[model samples]
Target: MQRPQTVVFTDLDGTFLDHETYQPGPALEALEELLAVGVAVYFCSAKTRVEQQAIANEFRVDVGFVVENGAAIYATAGAATVFGMPYAQVREALHNAAAACGAAVRGYGDMDVAEVMEHTGLDERRAQYARQREFTESFVIESGEPYELSQAMGELGLRLQRGSRFWTAQGEHDKGMAVRHVTTQLGPNAESFGLGDFDNDLEMLTAVDTPMLVQQHDGTWRDLHVEDMVRLSGIGPVGWCSGAELVLRRHNAR
Candidate 1:
């Protein structure tokens, strides 16, 4: 077996960030080592561009980021390349759907970050943290069937990515597509690894050569399509960091 130049792409929440402190642990060190050896690290996440950019800066390295659940891609220098439906088109469709379902449609584009925070009742600090970086954009419909919203977005040339607590019109774009794009850019001989821990990460996990899911607070592993999905023993970023290191060690041995 050949050991090709590797690139690791990881989802943020519940994967790279400690669920409590929102900080990276040994995973960051592992990534640094990979970079020391000429490997690349990227963050593919549902987080907005703003959020992902901040993380990239914190790590002090350039990152290829897929924001808005793959609706947009951004390079480390802050140049953005949108891949899917325009936000305007998605907004119109979501508005129509909200009216039909008698729900209120709220999003980040139409309002400032503060307004979105108020509507969603999210913590102000977290909202500010998300706003400081501009990588993600999302819309939610309050009071309607989530599937109805999904169907509506589908009709409008958008797709709904269902997370633990919200539905958004992100289009058919997903982490899998983002991974393919990055891998293609990196060349055919490049090896890939992925880490994630939620329903939204399914496509991403399937696209990688190695997929690992960090354990949740409940001590259960999220179901994944990969045949060799490894369940980490700890919760949040610690588990993710440990799992990523293990995967790399195993792959390097092979």
Candidate 2:
């Protein structure tokens, strides 16, 4: 019997990378193992291409990546391409919606490097990279009801995603749409495995043949109702490694 070609779509911050130190840690082993067996692991993240590029270089893994919450995709062999609304349009709509809703919204583009560093705990270089938004932008509501902001955004044909630390606004497409796009390019026979740890990851998690949810940094798991979703035992990358290994073992055994 021929094994199905494996492809993994994973969240970065709190899934493949440690939520605190932002390193792959134990997940590096499973990543290498997957690569050795010709599996492609695409990072689906809210980070900009610049930030994702830096992380990819740090890990020394060459793979396709979906950035800006599925706003764009950068294949390992081709240029980056947009899959969502233009960043300029999204920015204008966001501001207009926030104003109409009477919410004080502050996004990454509205902040300097110092302010970004203060808010995200990222160093200056990373903060600079994070601010280079090409598709999606993250903001916070400083002085208004979140529901009002959400209602306003929806009225303007935009959507808001609640991430671990900030609220992101972008086009209709999310990580699941990006994953589906990548899967088609991988050929009809390729099977997908997705791993994530937050509500924002729900789309990607539910789009895969095997969906895995790992424990968060604080030891709580994101509650999601997906068919056959696997909940791993460890937190962050530890659970990622375990879940990946388990999936691979079961997949190969069949």
Best lDDT goes to which candidate?
2
Whole-model lDDT, model 2: 0.87
lDDT by residue for model 2 (136-180), tens: 888877989888898999998899888767999898888888888
For each candidate, what is the lDDT? 0.71, 0.87
Candidate no. 1 TM-score: 0.83
Candidate 1 clashes between residue pairs 3 or more apart in a chain or in different chains: 48-135, 48-136, 49-134, 49-135, 49-136, 50-133, 50-134, 50-135, 159-171
lDDT of 2 at 71: 88
How much does each candidate deviate from the true structure in C-alpha RMSD? 3.2, 2.0
Per-residue CA lDDT of candidate 1, range 121-225, in tens? 657765776544233346556577777766665666666666565556655677788887877876778878888888888888888877778887576787766
> Which segments of candidate 1 are over 4 A away from where they belong?
1-3, 76-81, 100-102, 110-115, 118-137, 247-254
For each candidate in turn, the TM-score is 0.83, 0.92
